[model samples]
Target: MSDSEPRMIEILRILSAHDKPIGSKLIAVELREKGFNLGERAVRYHMQVLDEKGYTERKGYSGRVITELGRDKLEKGLVYDQVDFVYSKFEEMIYLTDFNYMTQKGNVVVNTSTIYDESSINILKKIIESGLSVSPYINLNEDKSEGKIEVTTLCGTTIDGILLNEGISSQPQYGGLLKIEDYKPIRFEELISYKKTSLTPLDAFSSPNRTSVLDVIETGDGIIPANFRLIPGVGRKRTLDIINKLDHIGIGGVIGISDEGRDILGIPVPEGMVGIAIVGGITPFRAVQENGEDIDIKIAEEIRNFNTLSPITTKITYHLKPVEHDIQPKISFLLSKSWNLIQQVNFDIEKRKGDIVANVSYLKRDDLDETLNIMESLYNDNPKYINPYYKVLDHPSDDDKVGIATICSLSIDGILINNGVICNPKYGGLLELTEPPLFIELISYNGSTVDPHKIFIAKDMTRITREAGSKKILASFKEIPYISRDYAVDLLDTLDKIGLSIYKISKPRELTYNAKADNYNFGIVAGSGLNSIAAVREKGIDIHVKAIEKLMPFEKMDRL
Candidate 1:
């Protein structure tokens, strides 16, 4: 394969990343950003070659766009050139990843897979809980037309991205199956060097019959997919520190790491380099395949926000078994009884404590039961939107005279995420009621340990329920990527149909009411799910509210 082929592939990639045509001059600039030394003249030369091959087509003087053939060629380049292209692409994705571990924000790379049969979800859940997968977090969306469920998992490349952000350079070495004994990784049983394959090595090595991940989980002895990497010896301590930090934040994939000059598992390392092995995110898919279920997976598909994923358990919350009958009939009475409770305006602060206490007790006993029953009904209806934490709470906390759990506005982020939209929730604040609602107070979601909504409420920053017809209320603003505007619109509409609280969704590069969005992103304003809870707190009622509490299935939520 000629060296120029890889450069052409890069051009195609740049074109694919954008929906508009691009000229050679602009392409050269983008290439320079990627550290390529290509100049405008050099890019034009390549463009001519691509044009002759019909891989690219010139559009109305706007320059050239990659054609369908170009997309195919980019995806499957010259076989001999693939190894270099694959590894180079890995580095490029790392550079593209903007996820900041410190702020707990930005996008991390992920692997997206699809399973057609609904029955395999339970098996996948077992694999995830058994710790045979990369991260406990996952993203799932159903494709009704294709009758498939798409699953997204954290790619091992995310570690490299995080490491790069920390000023540490990591070199991807290979991907293979690592044997395990007594729950400890023993050695690599099979290996495919990243520098020698056009395909993602982990994806290449994964096979239903070839892997024994289920056995590993059950017997503590078997094989699972793993990736190998090398980092400068001096960075071992720092690397471990990063891994520790990731673990604390619920992001796990690094299975094992070796000391300087030592081998990882049974693989030898360079003299001054340490070897690191990462558990492959494809393991869950492999487990499903091993169970004779049909599945499709794309390894290291793209970069996405670290916060976008939910625990794998959330995906299986409602679909684990078949329903014997409709639950709507069973829950209809409860829904009727609690309809007013769900739709009640913020409580009156002037009410006596005894009266408030009685109301709280009634809401707790009746509303709570109705909420759980609604979630169950939802699980049977549409499990994807249910919150995962509701299963764990059986009763209100003793300290909290009133306990209320509302679906946070951040749940919109989750919805957008599942639909391939990377939504960054920028602020949780008081949105003043006016001709155009304006945010008077704002707190960033990044770098905050506590939910900003909770902090605002605790600080008494809201006047949502101070009056019977208060104009001001709590709300949140999120940034949606410009390219995914259409997807976000449709998904937001779906949320509205389901009765989720949404205030405004801005046009591309526009403000939503008064919430601002950058040129590259659109803004979304959603009423805080805790608006009711906040009103209760305004009354001096001892109510505890949790925002973005947990990933609960949509089915579990009953709209107030």
Candidate 2:
């Protein structure tokens, strides 16, 4: 074929491979990889020739892409012979696997007119996925040697292979190439405000806003290295004083505002309004009152009369409005459609703190009661919320403290009780029974007989045998099956010999006292197998529970 004809074929191959417009720099790299060694001027000349031949079209300034005719030629294998010629020339030098070399040098160029082999197409897919520019080079041969694939860019930078695997297609422009005339500045006067009028039904008795505040307060109790601020106004001071009084009356400690509060709340306070901010945990909430002047005076009086301690107080000088535009007024169908398209642009942006929520699980009724009791006891003993409740979780940790109750099942090998007693004793001797008749059984394959009569005077045994020498154990106990104190002591001793551990006996009184709302049943349930409970509480709220139980005594269910 003639020189012009081959060049035209190469141009078609380039265009067909890339979905985006190609520049001279990129085109030259492709020609170089094809062993053409063409300069920018020569590539430009070839492109002009292709444009004249209706193989490709010029877009914007200095941008050229393949025409439909050029793509057709590639898809039909019309440019195969030309590609073969180019490949034959560069077979020894081109590295198919080393895509970085092409991307860095910007030598990986596309001529909207050339056809590409499947392997070349795969390489191009990788290059695009990496969000990196490919060098303008064409290689038709594949490299079999692993190290031969040195994926370096023209800038001499090595690229991670993972970058290439995540390639995505650039969003296509609409209306036959975007132009300045296609976009117009939005007219403020003509723009109609679209309001988000939808309202979620709020519970009458429980204020959603107040509940959110309480949640924030609970989260702030943890050892977070941040300051919390109270909003300006009389009600805030009064609320705080009440809380302080509650602390005096055996409630938890209150979080105080930090220096960061000024930074968060230094916005414009509306006429006859004051802003209060609390920033201990994650995000800050703003509270505004209709009468700031009057509220401030009332708060000062409350602080002086009620709270004799270092009352939480902070002074605010400047106030500002939230930086985020209230999008509720602009959320029209048209804007939503535009937003949907805008999101497709895939622009990188930062997210705000308010955009995220803490992944904390709500406390179960029984768990909540236990927590409250712990909190109340701490407050009563100290008259201050001094002892930060170290929440106990099911997982064992050295950092966990005693009485820091977690909503976890009593392991067959019971948790250590407050009285220094390992409730679920893996091995022990006779001792004073602190609570009551302890439940014991062999849930795993193990040996070491226990004399039930010696352990307890009135023994109600639930025994199962597993494979001898197995490590699993299952046992449970309730307070109802009362036994003599001496018998309990003997039982403990026998349990120590049998290699059985103790599981805590949950009391019913613990559950009933901590009911937050009326009609909620609070109790502990433990068993010896996979246990699941998903039931609705009295207030139409759902609770999910899961526990694992095991059978003891290796020989119980042998065959079947």
- lDDT, candidate 1, equals 0.66
| All models, RMSD in angstroms | 23.1, 32.9
Cα lDDT tens digits for candidate 2, 302-339: 00111111211121111111222221132122223322
- lDDT score of residue 545 within candidate 2: 23
- Model 2: how far is 435 from its true place, Å? 99
Candidate 1's TM-score reads: 0.52
Total clashes for model 2: 71
- List where candidate 1 sits over 4 angstroms from the true fold: 1-6, 35-49, 61-63, 314-560
Which candidate's lDDT is highest?
A: 1
TM-score of each: 0.52, 0.18
